[model samples]
Target: MTFLEKLKPHLISDDILIQEVVLHALHDYPNVPEEWTNELLKEAFRNKDKQSSIFIYVENQTFNEESVKILSENIPLMDPSERHLAVNLVQRIEPELALKYKNQLQAYIPKSTWALYELLLHGTEEEVYSEYGQILNDLERAGSDQHHLYITAKKLAACLVKKGWVTETEIDLILEEEIKGRWFSFNGILNIYMIGLLKLEKYIPLLVRLLERDEDSLLEELSATLISFQSDQVIKEVAPYLRKENSIIYAASIVENMKTDFAVQVLREAYTSARELDQQDILFEALCHQFSEKALPEINKHMELDYSSGLVDIEQTAYSYFSILGIKHRELALWRQVALERELDFRQKGNDLPSAPVRNEIRVGRNDPCPCGSGKKYKKCCGK
Candidate 1:
């Protein structure tokens, strides 16, 4: 047998080290036939080991039409884990085909998972919370680990909460349960998703607690939700967490996504405090993604540092931002004109930083019919 064939049995090995060895060995045989690869993938699926040898195999190759069809047809027959991989592969290759078979796929997977994904994709906020409110409840009851479906469900829930479909009570319930269950562990993806999705001002205290955890786990997800606030107050709310010495890099990433003057200010503070060149470089790249004139002073500061130190990456980053702003070296006069206008705009809006407005209302009694027109009591519907 050839060297490639020698490693085939390792694909079904429960040992992760052996599985990894086999996967790496497969890469050395790039000229392996597609038909042979597909057959091996089928066998890998049938004899999936703890390391998910099939998932690793699938990741190594992009599927063509025939292979895509083969995977799609098998998804409904696969177990939850294999089905997850198949769905992700199909979605990566042909998203329309994934949706085309949504109903059939949903039949095999949990309804909550499909309902949440559908809500994110096509449903209105009112319809999602009302039509699929039960689905969220089912997920809540599933806790943070219901055979990996929780991760998919919670990610969809996070998107919904950001879009304002979830209720305050639901948010509180999720927080209380997750905290009690110690779902704050770094490996608890669903726990972090629920926390990140709980965007209410009242929950800021809870988020702060999680942010300060030694693990600094889930910072990215939390940052994305915080950016959804899109207000200066959110910068203040997140500032304390960013103050941690270890959190500077993540703070830069979060503020970069925010793209508001408030966000720029927060990033500036983090950049100033960041001691490592690598962290500063990350912040620099993030700023390039959302360039504005308010960023010029810090950009100039870094440019000078890079000039004195004979570094080029930071200078390149600044020029990239300039290029994005339509400023060219030949347009020095225009650059000055634009920069002054931006400075003026900044000064005018400096004291007028907006805060995320919260709306409080008199909630209905538990016995009342849900206002969502779901014909269910408040306790059994949106209020839950």
Candidate 2:
């Protein structure tokens, strides 16, 4: 049987985690059977907690009139968030048809997902201010009960500044206060995110300073925002950090997200100059995510070196990166077939393994994405 044929059994399994993985993998394989796709698509919508996984399968669907009809039948059944993803997926599949179907999609209003912020934005300025004050008072009385709401407020505050809805004078004055505060705060990271969104070149230095702070759990937010600038200046200013042990993970994410030529060059140079195999592996993995054929030579060269030096047996590593060509080109390239077979073989081995237990019927590597849908590495989660 084909991989999807083998995978069909688990797509409707009671184990939602397997369903998520199978659905996510389907994105890399676009030719799913329409009837099966519709069945699973409706089932996924019924799962409120599935979040991103709900649409992944259908996003790759080759929609025909019948498929669109099925979607029209199901659109009204979804909540707004589900509707948003569903509508967005339809647009991606067939833009003109999606526009045509828009009117028929009941309760599919195009409101922002920020429900609390939406409330805050309504009414006259004075009324909004009074309501805002009441919200603050409620928050004070609610204490830590509304801590998540507090986080939303902070992120939205930064978002407002980015949108230029907040006045320049207020931005500068508040930033001055944030600037003077030397210590780390959760709000401060959100402020950093805001600064990156503003794309104000003067604040690049501030981000660089914070990056050097080497704060844990902050690198992802930090690198994502920094790379958003997409400026050559930002690339040069941050290149040195790539060499530091504390910062390579931050730099790897920057390389992965920033697809510009300079970002590629910086990573290639870093990979070439890296002294340790682990560091080289990190940089090389980031380069492979670029999916630029130009990096293939460096990747292969390093793979050969690692194997010869008794560092790592890297044949599978090379095969995996090569396999991504299928995902990048939107067709099942030859290596991707190899990947599907490899994954099936791996799974079958797990089923046959009698020596292991406690999630014994699972096969995944440490660096591989965790099957739990947490978007974390297996090593950091259930594999641990």
Candidate 3:
């Protein structure tokens, strides 16, 4: 018998497992008549076997207009768990219809879930803020589930941001409440970052405080965001991290993008003090792009090196500097010729070395030399 033919007998079997198996088997038969699938789902719902119906609807991705109609019809009959999934599915599948039954749904689903639905349905910002603002204020400190807190906070914050209603006083209140209430999480931090992006003057100090903790969790994202301000305070707060042995490469790149006098000084100092070639190259690239008078001295110093340090590759450094400095067309031709001749000389001097083999499964620090031996650090090469 065909798989569907064999599975049909179990649909009406008294055995619950048989009924579940039949519903699961239907997933592979997308070509099955819509009427047949709808009748099966309805039968499952009628028997209060909502789990089987929902599994097919949600997990198996078999939900359709027919499924929405069935769930909406059975909304009153479903228990809490069944009602939650049914309400969610209806809202997702056909939002206008979900709006028609919003009052009924409020009685079944969690308040947080219902609020998200209202937001998705485009409730006015003032209305959303009036209802959910107090809810966040009351519940945020009680250490509620990050899921509910995030869903509510993210949308509410976005509304406030869009309306230009966010203020230092308001931001302070939000931050103070969350801090006093201890509602920190990845989502919570992200919500604040979003708000901070909109209102930096009020929030950068708090961000600076978080960075000082040096937790390494979300540090890269936080630093990247803070540096975008390009303020002196932010530069001072972030510059020290570039000098850290472990954080140098990431901090270097972030500072590179800042492309300010402060950034150049930080990178130049770090490059001079750096013991490793990979770190130096990272500093080199950061400097080459800026190519200011302050940077030229460092570029000249590196270009004067006579031998390859396995990591520095002096000839490569000179080519990068000349290209970035906008050396004229004739100078470019000469540099390319000189670079090739240097490569030939290095090859003849037994100085050229083969790169290391790539490891299929090995973990190393970002600053560590890449195992593939391109003379680049792991972070810049294979580790990426």
For model 1, the superposed segments whose C-alpha errors exceed 4 Å read 1-151, 155-167, 177-199, 273-279, 306-316, 329-384
**Number of the top TM-score candidate:** 2
* Candidate 3 lDDT by residue in tens digits, 1-384: 333453444455454323432343333223355566566656667665344343333322344566656765777776663354344444343334445666644454566565565674677767766755565665556442333454455556655566666665666665676555433544345546565457465566666555534333245446546655656666566567666666665566556556468778877887788776666766765565444557777766665545444433344434544543445333445445665665456445433333434332222334433444343445566657
Cα lDDT, all candidates: 0.49, 0.56, 0.52
**Model 3: lowest-lDDT 10 consecutive positions:** 356-365
- TM-score for all models, in order of appearance: 0.44, 0.56, 0.43
- What clash count does candidate 2 reach? 0
Candidate 3, which segments miss by more than 4 Å at Cα? 1-122, 126-159, 165-170, 173-184, 212-217, 276-278, 302-321, 328-384
Clashes of each: 0, 0, 0
Model 1: lowest-lDDT 10 consecutive positions: 356-365
Please write out the lDDT profile of model 2 over residues 244-279, one tens digit for every residue.
Answer: 887776666665556566777888999888998878
**Lowest-lDDT window of 10 residues in candidate 2?**
306-315
68-126 in candidate 1: lDDT tens per residue?
A: 55665766666673354455445433223445666544444456555455566777877
lDDT over C-alpha atoms for residue 50 of model 1: 28
Ranking by lDDT: 2, 3, 1
| lDDT at 59, model 1 | 46
